[model samples]
Target chain A: MTASKPISLKDEGLEQKKRSTPMGDALRQFRRNKMAVVAFFIITFFIFMAVTASLWSNISFLDAPKGFKARHTINPAGLDRVDPYAEPGHCARDGLDQGKAWCALLTEEQRARFPNSCRVEIPDPNQRQWCYILGSDGGGKDWMTQTVYGAQVSLAVAFVGSSVSLLLGLVYGMVSGFYGGRIDNVMMRFVDFLYGIPGLVIIIIMQVYFREISSKYEDSSGIVGFIVEINKDLGGLFFLFIALGLLSWIGTARLARGQVLSYREKEFVEAARAVGARDRRIIFVHLLPNIIGPLLVAETLAIPGYIFAEAFLSYIGLGVQPGTPSWGEMISRAGQEGGFYSNRHMIYVPSAALVMLTLAFNFFGDGLRDALDPRLRGR
Target chain B: MTNVAKSEKVMTAPAKKKDYGDPIVSVRGLKKHFPIKSGLIFQRETAAVKAVDGLDFDIFRGETLGLVGESGCGKSTTGRTILQLHRATSGTVNFEGTELTTLKGNSLREMRRKMQIIFQDPYASLNPRMSISRIISEPLVVHGIGSERDRQKRVEELLERVGLNPFFANRYPHEFSGGQRQRIGVARALALEPSFIVCDEPISALDVSIQAQVVNLLQDLQRDMGLTYLFIAHDLSMVRHICDRVAVMYLGKIVEMAESEELYTNPLHPYTQALLSAVPVPDPDVEENRQRIILKGDLPSPANPPVGCNFNTRCPVAIDVCFDWDPELIEVLPGHWVACHRVT
Candidate 1:
């Protein structure tokens, strides 16, 4: 009998069929990856929160209303005459009863909920009736309002700071990697110099310098009520964004530079250069597209960095000023007198927000890294 | 014998008959020395690695000049320096009579369009993140060749020419095997339709059986497209198979140059003879009859090569003159140039 060869059973239907285009295939694979899908949702959730956080609560929750008209102006002495425990209707006029009446006017839930909370009149001509949701700070500004405003400030800062850092790092790294040799050496040396400096100390020094410059601008020649003008004209959101972004780009630049160094030597880059391509074209068209995957992952990881920085700075009282509603500020305010042990919600809410933000960003970053990886894209 | 000398004279005479043509690329007095640095805080340049030391050669039009050498003999460095991939410490590379060393920016890039290089390792050569189509079409896009449709068609054609399914144009480099990826690399090199290519050990990383296929493909492409190649390799047998003329390099200098058939049949340089003797013939009977010359000691450091002849330290037939005065490459016969005191 003739020796017989065994028929292979390894043939699958997918092997016989022509595969779709790589871009389409990559999209399909990305969709199939459950972790990546979940991460996409998480990223979407954070972005939605960041964009529409004010809409979820009162728009003015973090700010004093610009144009509020009061029904009556109360004398400060009159605030002392009111009985603390008297029934709402039996209260005497122009006494502590007014404060109690104002407190009682709040929903029954609020009355039973925050006992220390009370309404205060900002005798300032601009603001009228101000109710403290979590009570006032040492400056008698509404802590709840400040905390809400602080969210706007802190979140804006994180986003802006992270973006700036990402841009700077990507540019620096790509330049270093593309040119290499002496150029790489010089740029890397500068990076090392920056890295050697203590980050917190640098931030402190920068803040002190900027703060002085700002105060100078505020105090120069009494030009149309400066501090009040700046407080009104300069949104805390803008300051936070610019500050965090400027301080944060070095890390991203280092990552980009390393990736570019390896990538520039690859055959594809040589191919492009061989075609009489300009250096700019080779860098942007050939090199940059390959690096975007890593950059995306790096930027995503950097969001948490931005958040933590904002929280740390705010905790140390350099983050947000009074009358801003920031999660970090809320946590800071709550931590005073160890309120964390009693009013657990005060600590948990902002803490949970920060945690969720960081976790979401990390998940998205990991997903993006995998998605961008060429090896992972195929199968 | 008097008869042997006459035979040597006869062998070298007709070998010079090959046309030198208008030399397409000429590299003169090329030197690339990588500095060896010391000290922690302030790095001091202690010495230099003579990667490509005082090399001179010319590539005539439409000829595959095989650069055969041992590892670290500066074959690859020579290729890179010729392409200006490494800025030469001091050298002049003239491409189509244009002084390449002095050309900067746009002019240099314009010159590069006429020449390209294929790397050794297929795995690392192509970008892992880029699609085959992108990789192939990148040259076209960079040079502003055509619109999207024309570029697409060109990429597909190049892919097909390299024996890959044109449909795989969109696939990433990692999706392909070593051979297939090498084909993709070849396709990328062909995209710009350059006249000259530096085949930098193109098939060294491939399987032995697959190596022949790639070599054949390169030969076929060269014949059909009239492409000139500087095929650099450590494999002597493969170089013999593809090269028209072969230059064997030692350290950073060309030790011997002759037609492939002439070099194989009658090697003048001792190093060349030793190298040819080391190749394993396929037939068992011939292999048994061959005398393998096993040279002692590892190759000396390129940073500090031995004085006089670089190969004298390893030469099987080294005379006192081999150690006293370093030999210059001079035509022993009309065609064959050997840098050995014995040969001249």
Candidate 2:
């Protein structure tokens, strides 16, 4: 028995030696998943782009007309002066002249109404460079630059909104779960009450109400004046953060409460208590670490939901103000007059970005869930 | 060992009831009932699970008092209640002449430093995320006992004391086997230099081979530290091996308690007798010849126990009064206490 025991023990020792620490094991697992790795890189690339949006926007690919050059112009309504419904790649081929292939396509009455629609003589043809790589929107802003900048707003809202929810949820849930009895019942019921209310409708109403209040206090002095300045700077996106944060936390709160409720009864927690560890220590040091695996996964998964909600709100025109570059706002504009047919890149670029971001977050969250699960450890 | 047993028997002899010194911990009429709440919207009181219903016992200083019982007989609840881990619904636990039930906040915590518990499951007792050093040093950190360097030195010393390598301090609980983790649990429990430790089935979760090692370590610790232990377990042989006195519990009440050798040699209570009979003898001839008294029916639910004696429902020698009147623990022999109408 002793000889066999040593052999089996030696095998176990070898196995143990091969296995890394839990955190290291999780990282290794995450690296092993090819799709998750790809998603991680894609997310990182977008974050990089979002952070360096200003640098990308300043590149003078499309120069304003020089001396004796016919400048590309937009109508008062922000329509293209040459061809309002010009397809992507049209500007590069036509050089803003519009007479070559564009004029023949227009009706006689349309041509008569705007005689320079297709044929505008320009001395410096080189000045009319189509620098908008992903093409331009109806407002003629560079699509690529707007898309890059929009990433900043989307990611910021998602990150900040999720963080707010996570904080509130962790505190509220811990209090409810740890205390239990009447306090738990009352607090959980309040959570249920919040869950009963439709979050989207409340967010929209809050946005409108806060926007009106912000505008009224626009000139107020002191701290309120400072807040007003910030509000003006952020416009509706500021309120969007508040609304999203307030509305999205219920799920996290419920999850945290449930996790804590189960984990608080574990013998380790009881052991901590037996050692005369205070409630704060028990909750933060003992209970929190055990429940963090599930909470982390839940938080990761919740981020994509917030991002999607932001896009959804913005798509419906209840989100960020008209002037701000947001993915949803871009997608909304792409559904406008001749947008789908002519400037399809405007519709697809932002839409593709939004889909890719949500998918990346979800895939990464899945990897995290699998890697951090204690039951699946040493697999 | 024989001389100590003879002296303990003489001190606890029935004729001299007051000879035993003041108990280190005396629990009087301890009851811990968990309330059951039902209904979704407006929860109402449904029923209470009387886990530990009116237990009374005294644990002398520097001695191992074994609490043996069938599963769900509330041995664990009694231990936890004594430690004040679970608040008693009603009763008093006097630890070294201080009423523990009345103590609260800092006083209760200060009391807790001197009294610690080793849980049943080593796997669940130690935090998986914490290194052995952190787990052991936590009690010291909580009470602000020493500086960082002192705590580190103490942790390493504790690791060595618990029969584990000092270098294993940096490893997490999951890295160790069941026996190793139990040692870590012991190390953590001993960090405060607690005067009393409740070994709540400490070796039950370990392999049969490793169980003796843990028990020996615990016995050595008790001798070395002069620690009092309330050793709760269902394993009769092990209790007989280490405990000075043994208490047999049935449905949250102690049916019999006596010196370990006396109780095993001559069990007075019928339930105690039956319990002892269940233990298989090592000698095949004696095992085959011995009569095993198998009790009828499962343990009655503690939430709604039988009206009179809890064991009366299944007592082999129950009298007419056994069904109507509750039996009280009374001395029937020197150093032997039994709760049964027939025994008296």
Candidate 3:
């Protein structure tokens, strides 16, 4: 160090590529994990299926439009959608043979209600594939289409609910932990109390109250009215979102506070203070990046939980509008309509979708938690 | 808030160099005691750790004042207290004309820019989340010293001056070696062009070879910039090599202070005698035959230091008077000072 060394960067013989950042390091590690990679693809495939559900839905015999312009947009009322009440193996979802087999188990009145077993088979193979692809629920809704639409609902619940949790929890916990003393004591006690309450029960109570309020004010004109309108359009999903989101932030706050407690005493934080940086700078700059890794992995892993919570609420008949086609709604209505008596495929289709999604989220999240730190990745 | 902005502008402007040899930082009976609080909710102080019991020293402008002591002897605490990193418990630390203890808010931070510290453990000192360039220019950014382009240019200059390649600025702290990371810490400290720096055992964490390189770097930096330093360390040989004047401390009090050569050849206090003797001499004959003065007993707890003179519990030549009265630092020679009743 007595004399300045004259070696240039190019002469050092290191790689000329862009330097790896923490995110980049985490990404490099994520790509190396086989389960995570597979889970990532599967999740994206679910998203693609959800986003393009209305396409390729129409069968040939229904006289569905064949033009590109007709198929590009959503077919809400066209032959693209099956008779949601059509029996599982009837012309609603499966071929003539399965339809006859399923029709044998139904009473005469039930047989008359879903007329799919009485119709002739359509000769088009592509159209036929759309029928038996996942069969249908008690509503005669195509199971594959319902599964795709359920993905959309799950994604909505996950993102909106998690955002609420992350925003509220990060700020609450950071403030509580950073200014820890009486304030931390008082605030953390409140969070602990919130944790003790059954989150599902509280959300159910909230959902019941929300339903009454939204229906009573459905005709008014204001923010509440506006929300009621969205609720009607989304088929009661809006209330479920609010109920689930309001209760999910407690765990995130606890995790964030714990992380902040551990990081507040690190030397880098003291070094930042030594540089004359203000408290806000210390919290956001020096402190946040170090703690955000685990928090992110937790949030990702918790998405499946949010999805399941919404599913549970819907299953108990306290979530969504009657015909919303959410997976839980499908399962609940199938059982009520007695599609499970002999035609068991009604329950099997939606259950398989639910299990696959939660498993995918868990595998991806587990891999992410391990790979978030750059040092850990290197080792 | 505006005051901070104004101070930032003033600090970044051209620095006016000052003459050396006059006292730059004057400490008078400075003390720091950390409270040990009990209870979870309504906390109470049970005891206090007297890290720096009563310190009095003068750091001359552009000179390195070596502070040597055994582990847990408050050498690091003294440096931190002087920098206002840990507020002093009592007395005064007057930097130039301003009394440091009374400073608050923007003024305190403004005063902080005039002084900086190079911390030990290069691995822990730097922020791993930031790039090298961001770490170096953090003080500049905090003070709002320059435009982004200007800060980048200044960072590059500082890197080169600290003997690191400027192009490595984009890399993170984890990519660098311990020695290079120490150099980066130096660059960060030098970013503000502070008049005084507390080098808090900057070389203790490095290898023996790396320690020499870093010490030489610090010396070169001080010479070129005319910076004053309070170099705190336990390495007696290294302290002797780099310090113009040396102060030996025991149990949070200076036992002897004098020119490095004088303290080495003509030590007055028994504590200083034991410390210097512990440093291995280079010559084989001298190393084998040199008289060794090994003191007894472990260091007394800072929470409850022994009454009267702190060294009485371990001093080899203890007298009855030594247990009842604490000695004060007083000049016995032209420039040499000793804090022992035996010294004439």
Candidate 4:
């Protein structure tokens, strides 16, 4: 007898099923886009790195060491006596031989200036200063630990700032687009006025105002009492984020406003209105969902810009003071040694990290932008 | 003067014969004029766009009343105003026994449950992002009816009733063809089991073949569900086929109203006579025999309609009386209404 294929599922009894939830359909569609999935993974990796900074960093970055003395400190007298280019204890190594070799390169006048150098140097074994894995700066602090720890603070500011800006922009844009007319005019005019000001000037003003307040609190109370009363801990970072976000969100507000204006004219909005859905429901539920894709893309693209700004500010000594380890501080150190060119490692390491982080955000943001675009779907 | 009196006598000598029960909807002296503001900051009302200048009609129970007009004739505006979609500047829209214009909040929504509208573009009428089931279930959800399972079952029934496969309920509007999408729109409108529907040129955007199917489906639904309709279209041929009574509109006012067959067979008003003569008869010989009454000039702007009869500027048979005083809508025959000084 000929072998017969078993009855198929469709033929057996089951009927085709249809999706009941629109949310499920949208989520399924979102998952099918490979670039969006990759972006999701990349974002998750950065978030993981940010949250686990303590485990990654060699030093406890959160705790600022106030009284710890350096194991090695160069004395001013020693600076004059010792040859700057010679290795540690090289002055006493075979006294005349190595010292003469170092001196041979010098002119007769330079040798006369260092008359007592040969007797002044004392031979010492194992006299090397502490070396970090990524090597120490001129101040003998590990850059590897500092940079890893710094990522947390810089990333936090960018995320928090973008989030704050997104929230404010959404509210302002939605209200303006929904109410329209005079309310829209008044709100948009304020946004336009804010946009007219120089961004850096606003940032500087905010930083100075915050600094003055903190200083006033410090002066009113002792440092310990001030820490208790003013309570500037991570709270300070949050406040800074809020300040940056509030000052920098005009662009996002305008973009969101334009989106809402177009979205409000769509047939779905009219249908919602005709159905007697409240103004709030129509604005928030009907119109907002349609514009969320653009907003999300805008927010992702904004993160790297904010990150670069924060790093640039820190490089100029205007951001994340001395105690906080930042990529900008690492870069500043390299440049301080007469333009970080002599020690290329110092410059490239932090600069490379910053470039990598910014590019990762941009690449992922581009992926999200493509995935979120309604026109790019199904293919 | 003697000939005018003789014509008036001829107009209303016939006794009343048709009465399709009492009217479920009635509008009287409805007027909506929107002012034209100029000069921005030093704004002033320059003029007014009389969107629905003055309209009076009665939609009888268990009947489809077709309102036919060209674009800008305020047919859609009249429907919207009657439905209270636009807060009328001044009008009385009495539905059943209650007034619609004065009702607010829950009462108005309750009124909406009894009456609904199917829009021109099927693609736009239903929310594209919402699933077919969700789109159909919206009115039910908004009105707070039944449990989720019961609502789902009802949605499926409505889908089947409108001749759509129930399995397609999960699909977004974009997934369906234009005809299927229109069926989904019909299903959504039928979900509430409303007594009256404003078919606002529902099939105007569809294929000619699909238009007939939709019109037939609407008629079948009307018969099966005992639903009434205010069918608005610019197509006179379709109006004659589907409507029990037809009203012809020009500019912002109804110029003539009569039984569909009678209106097609004999149009009294000059504009109506011209419009009916323009529709080509399917029989070529008869079409050749007919005299086409083509009028001069384009439709007058609703913002600045003629001072007298709205159609006076374009009417081929317009007289001196047509340009002096605005004619009022009045019944000339037992059931037919017309607004023209010459007709009286």
Which candidate has the highest DockQ of all? 3
**In candidate 1, what are the lDDT values of residues A1-379, reduced to their tens digit?**
0001111223212346445554556577667767777867865765565456445334222224221111112233334432222221222333334545667667877666544334344244233322334544333333343444445555566567777887888888888878876777778888888888788777766656555556657656474346434543434344445566665777888889878877877766665655667787777776887777778778877778888877877676665554345677668876883545665545665777678767777776777666667667655
- For candidate 1, lDDT tens digit of each residue in B1-344? 34223333443334475765766887777789999987644668999999888766677789889999899999999998888877899868889989988887878877777888898899887766578888788878777789999999999888778776776777676656787788888888888888999999999999997787788788878988899999999899899889889999999988998888889999999999989999999999999999988888888899999988899899988999888877877778776878898888
- Residue-level lDDT of model 3, residues A87-135, one tens digit each, is 4444533344455556667788877755654344546423544444556
| Chain A TM-score of prediction number 4 | 0.70
- In terms of lDDT, the poorest run of 10 residues in model 2 chain A is A61-70
Listed in order, each prediction's TM-score against the native is 0.79, 0.87, 0.83, 0.80
lDDT of 2 by residue, A5-57 (tens): 12233534634575446688789888887888898998899899877776776
Identify the CAPRI category of the predicted complex in candidate 1. acceptable
Which pairs clash (backbone N, Cα, C closer than 3 Å) in model 2? A98-A118, A99-A118
lDDT of each: 0.71, 0.80, 0.79, 0.72
DockQ, structure candidate 4: 0.14
- Candidate 3: segments with Cα more than 4 A from true spot: A1-3, A7-18, A53-132, A208-234, A334-341, B1-20, B282-297, B341-344
Winner by DockQ between candidate 3 and candidate 1: 3
Native contact fraction (fnat) of model 3: 0.51
lDDT of 4 by residue, B1-344 (tens): 34234334443444244557667888766777777876534457899889898777778888899999888888988988888877788868889999988999889988887887888887777765678888888888888989999999998888778877676667677666677778777787788788888889988899998788888889888988899999999888999999999999988888898889878887888989888888888998998898998889999888888887788888878888889987776677777888888888
- The residue-by-residue lDDT of candidate 3 on B1-344, one tens digit each, is 34223323332232122223657888777789999878756778899999898877778888889999998889988998888888999968989889999888899899878899998889988888899999999999999899999999999999999888888889888777898899999899989889999999999999999898889889998989999889999898898899878888888888888878888998989999898888898999999998999989899999999887889899988888788988777667756778787774
TM-score of 1: 0.79
Say which prediction, candidate 1 or candidate 3, comes out ahead on lDDT.
3
TM-score of 3: 0.83
Question: DockQ of every model listed?
Answer: 0.26, 0.34, 0.43, 0.14
